[model samples]
Target: MSVLVYTENWDGRFKKLSNELVSYGSKLAEMLNTSTTVLSIGKVDEAELKSLGKYGADKIITVTDEKLATLDNRAYTAVIAQVVEKEKSGIVLLSNNNTGKAIAPRLSVKLKAGIASGITAVPEKTSPFTAAKKVFSGKAFAKFVIKTDIKILTLAQNSYEIVEKTGQAAIESFSPSVSNDLIRTKVINVEKQTGKVLLTDAEIVVSGGRGMKSPDNWGKIEELADLLGGATACSRPVSDEGWRPHEEHTGQTGKIIAPNLYIAFGISGAIQHLAGVSSSKFIVAVNTDKDAPIFEAADYGIVGDALQVLPKFVDAVKELKSL
Candidate 1:
């Protein structure tokens, strides 16, 4: 049996998590004493696909269908399921991102494989294939054992480290049995925020909340994020109040992120908000209320008015950069 990784691409390039998946799958393949293969969709540079060899992929199968360039969940799942069948992959690894969430369940059903989502660690035991994952909105951890012959796992972002190994991946073209009828939706046009880091892929995130008082005060938040070379985020209320876009919102009802560093300004750390960012490696909270719930969760906390403190913090960062 072989270990297969689904490496996702955006705008013809691989994201950081894609490399992590490859490396993770490679390590698992080594443990299983099998080869590791990667399946990529859409238009990606052949050279880049081959470079994944350094991450432990023995082979790279690419489907460069013009129609498959945009994400169509059904079509993508069908393609992946076909690859799993053809490769006889015992373990399938995917990133627990938007695409993985949308297509993983369908692929599991099609392949008749047991599936686990939001897995945070490598399999502890290979015989029963036990994996650790978060449950109850990150409040608890659970270990799952898959009994199926073939297993599918969607890994949480930043949960696994990327390790490089020496190897050259043999690239090949794979033509799956894709039908036009399987494509249920069409993406006519796409609008994306330009020149900013995507929250899911960012290492550092600076978030603001209702305590910012008004959208007019968001300049400092943006400036701080820019100065720190990070992305800007907000709590649910900030987006509801039109102070920030919904894409930037993070909470139980919003996007879940696990960045390396998450900084909060004027946020009270409601449980719902914590559910989204609780997995961050480090948290720094700045709020005027000393007893704010965020402080309990933060590694470092500043009890002061965010408006006055933000400028000073920005100046300090600038001074440090100059030195």
Candidate 2:
């Protein structure tokens, strides 16, 4: 049996998470002494599909259906299940992002496979197939083992490294036994936030909080993010105040992120907010309050007003770059 990874794409381009899945799955396949295959849906470029070979996919399966372009959880689950059975894949891997979170549970039920969601590492022990996962919003780690013959896993974003290998994956066309009737929901229109790094895929993130006082003051945060080529995020209160979009909110109740570097501006760290970003590799907190809870979680803490400090910090970065 081969290892099957669901490499998702949007607007004809593969996401960075998709490449990580391929890399993770391929390494796992090597450990299992099996081949790795990637299953993709929608209209992705043939060259892009074949390029997954460098990340360890031995074969790429593309299902080009107009109806499949819009994400219908039920329809996508059905297609994935069909592919798993056809490939006789014993292990299935998916990103634990929005789409995977939506479809994984449904697909697990359809395949009668034991699923482990939000796993942070590869299987620690292959014999028992134990995988490590983060729990309590990144506060704790737990090991989970799937007893079912067919195992499904949803990998946490940015947890695995992408290693390039030399190989050319063969691209094959796949038509799953999917019908239009299976699509219970239809997407009428799509509005996308364009020209910014998706938070989940960003290595560095610059975030602000209610301490920014108003949406008009977000310029500094955006400038920092732009300089670093990173994404901009906000705490939940900022989103609640409508100062920022909900998608940019990161906290226990919002999107969980684990970027390489997380810079917090004017954010007093609540446990909920920390829970969301505690997994970040390095955290820098800039707040006027020295006792801000965020400072306790930050690797480097600066007790100062963000509004006053941010401009100087940006100027320093610019000066360093020029030198």
Candidate 3:
């Protein structure tokens, strides 16, 4: 038996979360005394497929079909299910993203496997199996045990540290018996977001809130993000005020992100927003209000005005890079 990792692609390249999942799944495979294989259903670049090796994928099983390019849940699920059946993978791992969230439940139903979503930690080998996960929207943690023949786990985004190994990963191409009728969805238009780092996949994130004073000062936010080699994020009010796009908003009602370093400028850290990024490895808050809730969640807190604090923080980052 082997561990199967579902590799996700965006614009012919594997997403960063996919690499993290591969690393996690590979470690799980080692723990279970098995190998790890990645399943990709699309026209991914061969070079990209091979790059999975560095992140801990033993083999990349790619079904390079035109129909599988755009994610048709039925078509993609059928292909993955076929691979799992043929390979007899004991454990299947998926990244807890929009795509993974959509497909994991369906796959679990079909496989009749015990499914765990929002899993943050590796399963502790007790008697059956216990997976650690966040519950009640990061308010609490729970250990869920699955007592099934086959198990499926969806890892939390940016929760696990990505492990890298030396040597090249092997690539294996397979042809699946794909049916045209299985393809229920068609891509009408693909509107790609133009940026280097997707917020969900970003390692560092610089976020702003209503305390920025006005939307005109967003250039500072963008500058800081650029200086730090990360992406810009905003709070719900900032997005509601049209200061930034809705895609950049991070809150319980918006996009949830758990970046490694989440630097917030002028944010109060409302529970709604904290629910989205409470899992960040390190948080640095730059708010003028000493009583701001953001400071409570921050590993490091600077009780200063955002307008003054942001420029200084940017200058400090630049100075450090020069040295």
Each candidate: RMSD to true structure? 1.2, 1.3, 1.9
Q: On residues 1-323, what C-alpha lDDT tens digit does candidate 3 reach at each position?
A: 89999977877887668878988998898788889999987778888888898888888898888777788888777888899998899889998899898899889888999898989878887358788887777878888988888888999888787798985778888888899988878889977758667788788999999989999888988998888789989999999989899999998888888888999999999999999889888999999899989999999999998999888888898899983
The best candidate by TM-score is 1
Sorted on TM-score, best first, the list reads: 1, 2, 3
lDDT values, one for every candidate: 0.90, 0.91, 0.87
Clashes of each: 0, 0, 0
The candidate maximizing lDDT is: 2
Q: Work out the TM-score per prediction.
A: 0.97, 0.96, 0.93
Q: Candidate 3, which segments miss by more than 4 Å at Cα?
A: 166-168
List clashing residue pairs in candidate 1.
Answer: none
Q: What is the lDDT of residue 23 in candidate 1?
A: 89
> What 10-residue stretch in candidate 1 is worst by lDDT?
7-16
